[model samples]
Target: MTRSGRLSRDAITAFALLGLIALFAAMLNNRPQTTLSGGFNVIDGDSLSRSGDRFRLVGIDAPEYRQQCERDGVHWLCGQEARALLVKLLQGGSIECRGNDRDRYDRLLVTCRTNEDDINAEMVRRGMAVSFGSYRSEENAARAARAGMWAGNFERPQDFRREEQAGSPKGQDLFAAAADFVKRLAGWN
Candidate 1:
């Protein structure tokens, strides 16, 4: 292949790697989607221990692996539960993914799903994550409607981590937050 051809091939490879990163990042970004999508099983959260390159959930952000509870006042992590749920949902089914771009941490900004279910939305509705699309209006709407991590008294999942990094309370409430999300969506109490 000519030098130009080789350069093109390398660029394609780099792009592919970046896309992969966005997929992983979406799951961690706290911007889970509520629409059906799909892709390959990429990475299994350390908690799940599953084998596959999961088409990372997009549009929402779940708690980190080193978060803490506010009531008991100790160190803890809730991301594992969220990861387990994702693994269970995959069911080895096909996952559709919406690839954006890779973040600094090398995760995909993609929307993932299987059949007709949106894992991202499920995560938020289930109160396992929040809307990390703080600056993005479209994503913000999804987050607001889902009453994601930002719905209740608890802070956004991303912010929670920031607090931990700054030596503050790592608060979370999936149950109450889910209920609040339902309510925020103008759901009948």
Candidate 2:
């Protein structure tokens, strides 16, 4: 204790040292056990292909390539905007991804970062994406701020797909476009 009855210098220093140690330990514990590091090309807002491997940014869902959303009574190309924003983020540096599972669509599910910034979290924070699997805090913040899709009415990507399938002629909706996208990506067509 001192004049103000607070901790003494030595005691405060000891506590600070302990806090530092704990913070270091926590950082070590949270480090990704496995990571994929390399140059990547942005496939869409939440997807990238690195070294021929397609990875989907886990815990976030962005609009589809052709999906539209209504904002202020006008339709906007939210998907294109999301893709452009992701491209901007990627321009900052290379990305590193870490995760093991693959989605049913044959895309690796991973959390990616450019340097120390989490791309998935940034997308949700900016309203370019909605929390899908886990990342609710970032999405909540964006929603509270009325960012991205939160600014207007928009269908969830999955819901949009379902509706497209149900409403399209002969149940073939957007498949041709998606296939063309893949072909163009792979230089196959």
Candidate 3:
């Protein structure tokens, strides 16, 4: 407040900025979810592209493209297997994805379906992917069955990415990089 009993100029400016931020947040929340439907190009186990737009499947996490896992003392490219499974799931049908959120990478975060199958849940159920935020029951079934990666020993996808980042020339500390990577992976920022 000013000596004249009015809000000072700086205070008014701060309030205006806060108001704008609130309005922006409201607009984002009010936006309707979008649905994308078509044949999709598989990018990885948990991602796909359609018409140049990339989408990350919601509620699941798959291995990095070069990640390896061990089963019965034999190493295998589990990431490639995951991708192949995703491709197999999308075969012979058009896919549909619906969501309003985007990841930091600007890929739409979507729940995808082909025919009557929930693609994300299927991935977790089959153990090609782990449940990130949904499909707990499916993950449980996969674990019980000892299916896919669940049958082997493998690093979690987020842990693998964090280690890779920490080893890079960026010079970030392992703990800090791990924290940041986990936050991004969990969509906390």
TM-score of each: 0.46, 0.72, 0.76
Q: In what order do the candidates fall by lDDT, top score first?
A: 3, 2, 1
Tens-place lDDT per residue, model 3, 1-189, is 556555576678899999999999998799689998878899889989988899999999999878898999999999999999999998848778899989999999999888878999999999999999899999999999999999979999989889978686476756677788899899996
What is candidate 2's lDDT per residue for 84-126, written digit by digit as tens? 9888877678778888677898888889888899988999899
Model 1, C-alpha of 60: deviation from truth (Å) = 0.6
lDDT (C-alpha, whole model) for all candidates: 0.55, 0.86, 0.89
Model 1 C-alpha lDDT per residue in residues 114-176, reported as the tens digit of each score = 778766666666655655553255445645664433333445566765665555323435555
Q: How large an RMSD does model 3 have?
A: 10.0
Give the distance in Å from residue 10's predicted Cα in candidate 2 to where it truly belongs. 60
Candidate 2: RMSD to truth: 12.4
How many clashes in each structure? 32, 0, 0
Q: What C-alpha RMSD separates each model from the true structure?
A: 16.5, 12.4, 10.0
After TM-score superposition, the amount by which residue 126's alpha carbon in candidate 2 deviates from its true location, in angstroms, is 0.3
Please identify model 3 stretches exceeding 4 Å from their true place: 1-27, 171-189
